[model samples]
Target chain A: MNELFQKVLAENSILLFCYLIGSITFILGLKMLSHPASARKGNLVAAAGMLIAILATIFLYRTENMSHLGNYAWIFGGLLVGGVIGTLAAKKVQMTAMPEMVSLFNGTGGACAMLISMVEFNKIMEHHPEEMHRGHLLIIVLGAVIGTVSFAGSMIAWGKLAGKIKDKTIPGAQIINFLLFAGIIGLSIALVAGFATTLPVFYAILTLAAIYGILFVMPIGGADMPVVISLLNSFTGVAAAFGGFLYDNPVMLTGGILVGSAGTILTILMCNAMNRSLKNVLLGSFGGAKPGAAGAAKEGGGTYKEISMNDTATLMAYASKVLIIPGYGLAVAQAQHTCHELEKVLEEKGVEVAYGIHPVAGRMPGHMNVLLAEADVLYEKLLEMEDANDQMSSTNVVLILGANDVVNPAAKDDPSSPIYGMPILEVEKAEHVIVNKRSMKPGYAGIENELFFRPKTSMLFGDAKKVLQELVTELKQM
Target chain B: MFQEFAAFFITNYRLITIVILSIFLGIEVISRVPSVLHTPLMSGANAIHGVVIIGAIIVMGSAEPNDFVALILGFLAVVLGTLNVVGGFVVTDRMLEMFGKKKPKK
Candidate 1:
């Protein structure tokens, strides 16, 4: 073989080796991520792979290509800005705000793809304007049109997540949404018809793309964010891959392909969780007008008992064993840190502390766990409902923080309630149940939480974090 | 070494993108399960974002263009790309919060 040919093969081998190693790391990361016990290890493994890949790439780069140095400068600068922003958001966002964060990530990923497509357009226009072949042009136009829609659609998702777009059903929203999608698809087909070089066609496609994005995600609500987030993330991946094709870059193509495929699959999975399709979830205004029924139900079965933080803390302090039950309300109030402090105080008194976690405790899956981890709680202390329920008989006190649904006895007894079969924290089996909540309002599923009205349960109504803090202060006194 | 990969990556352009995006989406799907594993998925995905920092190498390697617009845009992509990479790590670390201990009910 020619020496230059051999050298090229060797280089390819090295890069391929690096890529495989990185891919293995990802697989290992996923495997380890299957449970909390191994998550840290998985993260470390994945990080190691990333580190290796980065190092390998640096080693492979030829010194001859010095002109692309500006890309490095941009990369580092982006790291600085994005890093700060991400850090601040993580630190500041309440546990309850995680769904919103997911939504924002969905938006950001789409925007990044959109921007990548724009850059690709510039590259094609400047370097190979006349050389643009039909296939490449098709990819370019598809990228621009899709990328734009994803970007604006993700923003609308953000709005829905933020409650800026109210849950109220708007007349003709569905028809309008369908028309927008159809029109965008039609324009996209036209865009691929080798007419992209025309200015009016290009601009019109751009307008339609932007509008389509907004309309695409506008009807989605907070309840369906996880699915939307996954779908949009997949869209970003596809867009990125197309951008990679335009640039003839192997890395982008591979990376984009991975993201797009993975995202699509995940979107499907999320949809199944809600027993809906991507189309229905995005267009049907899911969870519409149903929660209002819960609002009304909350008004009935309204037996009342209230307690102050100090009183609640005194009970917690005196108890020899305590179990904390967290739900969406806990996440919403960002009370994890304060709850951690309460855990510490209770533990100091020789109280055995445990947390009962339900499968569907928050808006998104694992919502409660994320919040508790933020408060610096031990991973071992959290027991699943099945595991913890067996122990509830011996539990002296069950502190319900920011929880609404998971403790409701109606799940086991009332056939009429929506959450009848769903397993919950068996707090009723405990000696005492102390629930800290914002109000008597029903949870996302809109069922009245009978736990709130239980005779043994004392309702400490206020903000969850604030009440947790107060309880901590009182625990200190006790 | 990561810097080198970063440079190689930006230079190679799109070689890694398709694979990365596919993996990302796959993780997204897998992580949606309300099981004990979602956090780990996020952490792993985040670890892959280390690829973003390589954008620095790309920025440094690309030529200074005669026309400033593409140059500026390219520069911006690299910068943002790098930010996304490092930020991904930080976010991954935070995601580890999913492993918090649940207090025993008894």
Candidate 2:
């Protein structure tokens, strides 16, 4: 008995040591992520920490009174399959598809939390039917409900973002969604109240929760996808935290709490940037039909002045300072490299160049920054909206490349505009404004840009890449 | 019985305090990230939640062979937890790789 006790003590001490190292590295890794330069290393360090934690749990931490490790085959098989699929998917997914990928992965995490709780509850039902703790039951129910919702909701979000699923509201979607939510809460209460221990009732709660998840995301529009994704991401984290509570695992608990709070803060930041409240985003479902409706009214916009490539080149080359604003158009045209090339050539000609990035410039937050960074653009040259506006009046020329709504003066001047209260880059304040786009077509919000019609603004119409390449050639000739 | 309950409460109290503290710590750490790193930061956080695989492993290790439901759920949880961890970290590394100064040709 003393020998067995010694072995157990040794195993536990080693496990504890691993957990300590893992948790510390996780904290350090997150701290390092504050700066762009250290972010990659931070990720690797945290991954190492996870490796240690996983290994210790598998080999060192023994379950009480077990003769041998139970079912190593299942655990190793899962790790092998999941690792292969995840690595392949991560390697293959394009940066443009990142939002969907994040959503999909987050869904998997939620599914795991849900499954863990279900398994735990099943164990309790079989082995300890006569004894049930209210706290444990409550945590299990919370995990089940939240995890199911996040899983189903994230899948829907992924489908919608990938264009595999259309944004369609069922008749009376709001009412149905509310009813499903109520039913889930009611069922959860009943389960916690010890009404029954049968699997069917538990499964019923899961089904209702899953349906509620689908309903929760069904009405949200593409424009609000980032916020919805972030919100659901937080739900998964919170669900995982409940799992942590149930299992009494500190590392799991810490990880879940970190993700939950971070996702919540990000969601709030996204809402504030878009000038919408969280309630408005969840309940109003505001951006769904606006784009289509506004697209039909495109005929009423004033004609924008056009500019030749030669003129745009001449203006930019002669300018002392130029500011470039990029948006989804740049991403669509795959023009980031060409845009960077233009900046390089213009800089060689003694012109100062920089980029102005709007908070919601592209499909996702920080979309423009990533695209620009991929093209080897200097990080310091990427300015936030406020800072860009601060220097706009002094800028010799403003290049609006594939960007519209964020630079649209209507956001500030027209109170009737749908995006009136949203903050935008004040590109119209620059001395000479040049807008590059495929056509006079409005942006994703489907609203006309009054800045495009300003006397100081002239349009250089073409695909953003082609136009930028042409401008680069013209600048070279000069 | 009262002493046992008090001990349980004390243990839980420590955990609850830790949970609340970690929440604040999470927000504080992420708040320092610039908008430029938001995507990677978010993805990295997504990977951290994959830590729950430990819980899944524990459940599977403790479960009996006859506990089919528990076995299946535990297996599925392990797979999902692994996927989230691997995918999130790899994608984040790929993104962050894009940033920084380019190397000069030798």
Candidate 3:
């Protein structure tokens, strides 16, 4: 149409194209990630797209200026500071914290969204403070509100994972959350009505968002955090996408959509790990077994027969099929490699060894898998809850190696318990069950494992690593 | 890099889509037949995040007349990329730390 407009479009075409490509990469990469085998490639292709998108945007923006070398200097300084911190953190953070780190990154994205929206708002205010079109102004205000809330909310989620925020109910949490929501909404409405400006009400809304974030997450126990973390991550993405709308940026919209959808899907998966519906995860207090439930009531009554390492090794060495159910106990004792050593010794004796991993065995999803993977256990040797359970009943010996809640038969038998309907590894259903544990302190849910007292169940008391070591030594003699 | 392909990319996005889909699916289908070929999915993702460092480089290098908005975005990009780099290595370290550990008495 117009020559100048055409020139502007042409000048920025590469950025626009890069944004589109990055969006496509994000979409296809996530789809390919459905299967664990191709997930890495999917991640790579998507990351390439992200790099292209950001660089294109930055380069296009830089073309508008050429004389301010000091401005370039500041950008350089930011790079150096960020590069050192980010690289060092990534190099040092544990795999278990991957999900948390993801949350933190998502929070940072939200921060960008908030900062950009604020900058734009300030620019508009400085330029045309008196010419507020109520409708357009409303859009910007709404974007700022959503973006700011998402930023603070995601930050709170990150804090929870970083140990900056502790999980304890700050008395009257629900009442306070309700008040904050009402106050923020009222303030937002007042701003739109031209009765107030962000100068006063903005900070007030921010305080509410911060409190809401704290109150929202502090009530959720550590066990149910994955779902919460993923949910907040998606919130951050949505916030960024909204900020894009405020700036009229097509690339931001597309990238944000991909992140939002993928993050939401991850949240759903995390919920399923806990056998929880999205609604339940948000509104219900799930995970810990309620008092006087089956695990607690039967705690003192069940006859938990004990076994020595030698006897445990004898059974494992001779058994035709041995299923090892590993849990947080294994992680707590860091016995994964020793377990692998024991498995190898059994394999040498012509015994089949497979590890049974429950969906929510440890504090987070895939906790046991990472531990076992570090032990250099073959990926094929690890069976998911469904796969491992199908074969458990046919196995000769089911070794409950330091797992607690995952292999507990009480979960299957007790309907009144909190984790009642959650899917669990059927190590309890195996022909012979041998439990390794240090004490009967109950699991994180405070539930006694009925698998311990089953007629076939016998406790082998020792640290997971030491017990596995002793078992390996005994199996070597066999 | 693909200025010549721009026309094809604009007109036939399907061709690029098909090529990428085939490569990824090919690797995936191959893995299913042999479980030992478990794809290094996490490591691959780590590498992708690593590519952000290159993006950071570009952003830092190309800020000619330095748009404040672009500068801010670039600064954030570097931080994000570095976190991934350091965190990935740290996880590898801690995982390595877990090897050969024995369980204490239950």
In the order shown, the candidates' DockQ scores are 0.23, 0.56, 0.10
Tens digits of per-residue lDDT, candidate 2, A1-478, equal: 9998888888888888898787777777887876776888899999999999999988986765735457888989989989999999999998777888999999999999889888888877877877777677878889888999999999999999888887777778888988987888887778777776567878899999999998888878776777898898888888878877887877778878878988898888877777778987886446555666566556666667898888899999999999999988897788999999999999999999999999888767887887888889988889998999999999999998888888877788889877788999987778999988898777766677878777999988899999999899999999
What are the per-residue Cα lDDT tens digits for candidate 3 across A318-416? 799999888767866778788889888999999998988786665456667666876788777788878887997889998887777766665677886
Reference-based lDDT, each prediction: 0.63, 0.84, 0.60
Which of the numbered candidates is closest to the native, going by highest TM-score?
A: 2
Find the candidate with the highest DockQ and give its number: 2
Looking at model 2, what is the TM-score of chain A? 0.91
Q: How many residue pairs clash in each candidate?
A: 86, 0, 31
Docking class of 3: incorrect
lDDT per residue for candidate 1 within A59-92, as digits (tens), equals: 5644343211334444445556766776676566
Number of the top-ranking candidate, with lDDT as the measure: 2
User: What ranking of all candidate models by lDDT puts the best one first?
Assistant: 2, 1, 3
DockQ for model 2 equals: 0.56
Superior by DockQ: candidate 1 or candidate 2: 2
For candidate 1, the per-residue lDDT at A323 reads 94
